[model samples]
Target: MSSRIIAAAVAVAAGLALAVGGAATLVSLARPDRGIDLQNAPAGNGVDGGVVDYGTK
Candidate 1:
C-alpha cells in the first residue's frame, strides 16, 4: 500500500511537470511576430517593391 501511494505521487508530479512545461512552450510561441524577431535577421528587399515603387512614382 505504501509503495502504491509513493508511485502515484511520483506519477502525478511528473504529469504536472510535463503539463507546465508544455504550457510554457506554447505560451512562448503564442506570438507570430516573435518568430521573426531573431537576433540576427536577414537583410533583403521586398519582392514586389519594384512594382509598387514604379507605379507610385
Candidate 2:
C-alpha cells in the first residue's frame, strides 16, 4: 500500500483504539463497587454496621 494510505489507516486505527479505550475507562470508572469510599460520605453504613473512614483523619 502507499504511504498515504498506510498513514491514514494508522490514524484511523489510533482513533478507534482511543475511542474504545476511553469507553472502557468510563465504564470501569462508573461502576459502584468501591470498598468504602467514606471520606465524602462518612455517615453511611459500613461493613460491620458502623461508620468507616477513608483515611481522612
Candidate 3:
C-alpha cells in the first residue's frame, strides 16, 4: 500500500511536470518575435514570412 501510494505520487508529479513543460514549449513556439518558423507559403505567393509574421507589417 505504501509503495503504491509512492508510485502514484511520483507518476502524478511527472505528469504535471510534463504538462507544464509542454505548455511552456507551445507558448514559446507561438510567439512571433522569437518563435520557430512553421510557415508553408506557396511557391509564387510573393509573401515570404513566418507563421506568426502576419501583423508585423
Candidate 4:
C-alpha cells in the first residue's frame, strides 16, 4: 500500500540522518580545536603530573 511505502521511506531517511549525525559527532571529538604547544609549555609532571599513579599491587 501507499501508506506502507511512505512509512518505509521515512524510516530509511531517519536512519540515514542518525548515521550522519553520529559520524559528525565522532569526527568532531577526534580533532582538537587548539594545537598543543608542548615546547613552549612548561613541564611539571609530564602529561599525568597531577593524575594518580597506580604502582604494582
Candidate 5:
C-alpha cells in the first residue's frame, strides 16, 4: 500500500482510540459508584486536629 494510505489508516485508528477513551471517561464520571460522601467530608480541625502540628516547631 502507498504511504498516504498507511498514514490515513493510522490516523483513523488513533482517532477511534481517542474517541473510545473519551467516551469511557465521560460515562464513568456520569455514574460514580465509589460511595464516597464528599459533602460530609471531615473538617481539617475535627477530631484529627488538622494535618499539621505547629507545636513541634
Candidate 6:
C-alpha cells in the first residue's frame, strides 16, 4: 500500500484505541459502586491533625 494509505490507517487505529480507552475509563468511574461513605467513615483517623499528615497519628 502507499505511504499515505499506511499513515492514514495508523492514525485511524490510534484514534480508535484512544477512544476506547477513554470510554472505558469513563464507564468505570461512572459506576455507582457505593464508594467510600463520608457519613459512616471512621472518626479521628488523623485526617485533619496536620497538613499532609493523612491518616497518621
lDDT of 3 by residue, 1-57 (tens): 999999999999999999999999999987785323436434445565534445664
lDDT per residue, candidate 5, 1-57, as tens digits? 699999999999999999999999999888845566676676765467656456774
TM-score: the better of candidates 1 and 4: 4
> Per-residue error at 33 for model 2, in Å?
2.1
Models sorted by TM-score, best on top: 2, 4, 3, 5, 6, 1
Best by TM-score: 2
What is the Cα-based TM-score of model 2? 0.52
Specify the poorest-scoring 10-residue window by lDDT in model 4: 34-43
In model 4, which runs have C-alpha deviations exceeding 4 angstroms?
35-57
- Which residue segments of model 2 deviate by more than 4 Å? 36-57
Question: What is the per-residue lDDT of model 4 for residues 1-57, given as tens digits with 9 covering 90 to 100?
Answer: 999999999999999999999999999998855456455554466564565458758
TM-score against truth, every candidate: 0.44, 0.52, 0.47, 0.50, 0.47, 0.45
Number of the candidate with higher lDDT, 1 or 4: 4
Candidate 5 whole-model C-alpha lDDT, 0 to 1: 0.82
lDDT of 5 at 10: 95
| Tens-place lDDT digits, model 2, residues 1-57 | 699999999999999999999999999999875666654464545544775478885
Error of 4 at 42 (Å): 22
- Which residue runs of candidate 3 sit more than 4 Å off their true CA positions? 34-57
Tens digits of per-residue lDDT for model 6 on 1-57? Answer: 699999999999999999999999999998865654555645575564534446766
Candidate 1 lDDT (Cα, whole model)?
Answer: 0.79
Model 6 vs truth, CA RMSD: 6.2
Give the Å error, residue 5, model 4. Answer: 0.9
Clashes in predicted model 4: 0
| TM-score-superior candidate, 1 or 5 | 5
The deviation in Å at residue 9 for candidate 6 is: 0.5
Which segments of candidate 6 are over 4 A away from where they belong? 34-57
Q: Candidate 1 lDDT, tens digit per residue, 1-57?
A: 999999999999999999999999999978668556875455458733433245553
CA lDDT of each prediction against the hidden true structure: 0.79, 0.82, 0.77, 0.81, 0.82, 0.79
